[model samples]
Target: MPLIYAKDGAVATFTIDNGKVNVFTPEMHRELHEALQDFVADPMIRVGIMTGAEGRSFCAGDDIKTPLPDLTPHEALEAHFFPHIHEGRTGLTRPGWEQDVMRFKRLKPIIGAVDGYCLGQGLIYLLLLTDIRLATPEAEFGFPEIAYGMAGAGGMTRLAALIPQAVAMEMLLLGERIPADRALSAHLINRVVERTGLMAEARAMAERIAGHPPVAVRLEMEVTERALDMTRDQAVDYAATLFRFQRVAYQGYGAGTGFFGTKHEAAE
Candidate 1:
């Protein structure tokens, strides 16, 4: 299988192993969508770690060697107007996996371990899918689609949201690869480590997240992602509502005294 999904305790690991650089195909995208669905539905899985199978690359992006299928005019129109209708069918349109993955209503947090080339679709996944990221010193990050006369709309939009406009524009317009250290400086990745310790660090972070209250962790993820588009007052109000709901549903935490905890009350 090009994509491998495995579970260890509360942690789920997704490894992309298509080729030396782990370029994705339509089949791989379908597999990834199924894997993410499984992860979201499985109550036992609390956190996820995504990486390439080998140390060569996290992912180089889509496989250019794969031939594009010839589509009829009607099929092309269906592809544009009703993409999800072709979910089980392939070759007629670009798969809607990107939107499906990003709009997951109950997505668990995913940590990215990037070792080498993370360009094009790979960079898009890093920007939108994963919550925390670790990269090796030799890792390279960029959007190479612009050079080929493609806009790479997915990566460009998400990258601009994450980093400054100037940096995002430079990357999108020039198609230049950024080194791991440069990526870290730009706040694109969390840390730059040796290839040997990359997965280890990622796993450790996943485990730490898994140890937290699952509902609280999920609440944090939802609030933060949604808050990006919310006004400050709206964000605070939304968080307060969710916080109350979680406390009521989970019976609170921290020595059974609610989110404030006994220590906080004692100090008060």
Candidate 2:
């Protein structure tokens, strides 16, 4: 199998296992989407950890060795626009329109554990969507699309919001490789650990996030993602409403409706 799926308590793990490089193929794309959908539908799994097989890279990006899909214009539109709907039994189990990137942005949180080369479109999309990213010191990051006379798509457009525009442009325009240290300095990743400790660190982080109330975690992520498109004043009002709604809906959290509580008093 190109992918491995497992669940441990409230945490779900998806490991990419297509040889050492773990290059992305068409089948891998559909399998990964199915695995993620299974994770989301299961009420037991509250958090997810995405990593490569042991002693291998997270992903070396798209599999250039494999041939690209050849589809007619109408077929291409059908594949993109109506991936979820199928005409017959043969199409029933096909992967839906929910691409990995789309699934990554959904309700649950995901932690990315990167050990080696996290490069090209596949890795870049994952890196941007992951809530928290842990990488080894030797891990390399970049979008080499410019070298191929192309530009990064999908999550690349959101890079400027996450990191400095100059830094985002450097990778997008120059196709430059960013070392782990540089990525950390640019705040592109959350933490950098040794390869030996990367998975342990990622799992620990996922466990911590999973320990939180699932409703609260999902709503908080939704609010945060939505707030990115709002003005400061609008975001404040929107968050206030969300806080009230969450309290009413979940009720597991207190109903006080006071998000900040009393102001802190400085020591004299």
Candidate 3:
């Protein structure tokens, strides 16, 4: 397998194998999926960092030469293939690696460490999913689908929501490669880091996120994904249920002071 996973203090690191630019083969994709599911189910685990070993960036996307075999290669090879997450519009008639994307959506906090060119499916892997993006100073990102006369169908829909409209349009329309700083300015990436300190920053961030209450973190991520599509009032209304009056954590009382309180009264 081209993907390698390791853990340190409630945080898991999934490193794409260095050879072939950490591309996702069938086994690699399966590894990524399993790693995600493993971390998702393990309550003790707090966060995950996806990166590429022996490189400055994360992954370069799927290796078409040796595509993942879990599903057919036809859907994977399609130019304008994607699953609609809005209004129940499943566009294409072909079978999607639904289990993969759906399984991916279940992910909470995954930070990307981009080192080099993240092309094609690699671009899709970075954008449509990962929570935080840590791009190295020397790293560049692009969806070269247009270069090959194809569209970034996998992640184009998400571009509008990830960054400003105009910038997203420029990226999708022009299909030109942009550096990490540009991505950061448009809020496409969370932070920019030096190539030398890439994984360290990602690991530190993962640790901090892991320190938060797991239940609350997981629930917020799960709910927010669905809530983002709603209108403002609908958004508010939908969010209200998450703020149930019964949960002492949301009752305006300090944590551990209301119901879970024992030896320490939560500070006001």
Give the whole-model CA lDDT for all candidates, comma-separated.
0.81, 0.74, 0.67
Reference-based TM-score of each model: 0.88, 0.83, 0.77
Pairwise lDDT winner, candidates 1 and 2: 1
Highest lDDT among the candidates is held by which one?
1
How well does candidate 3 score on lDDT at residue 164? 90
RMSD of 1: 4.3
Tell me the spans in candidate 2 whose CA falls farther than 4 Å from its real position: 72-105, 154-157, 249-268
- Per-residue lDDT of candidate 1, residues 1-268 (tens digit): 9999999988999999988999988778778889988999998888999999975689998898876565678876776666566655555236445555555555589999999899888888777779899999999998989889888654535777888879888988898999999899999999998999999899999987776766677789989989999999999999999999876665544453432333333222
- Point out where model 1 deviates above 4 Å: 84-93, 96-99, 154-157, 252-268
Assess the local accuracy of residue 49 in candidate 1 as a C-alpha lDDT between 0 and 100. 93
Q: Per-residue lDDT for 125-233 in model 2, tens only?
A: 5655478988899888888877887674425447877889899888778887899999999988889999899989988988777766666677788889889999999
Worst 10 residues of 2 by lDDT: 259-268
Candidate ordering by lDDT (highest first): 1, 2, 3
Clashing pairs in 2: none
TM-score: the better of candidates 1 and 2: 1
Report how far residue 41 has shifted in candidate 1, in Å: 0.5
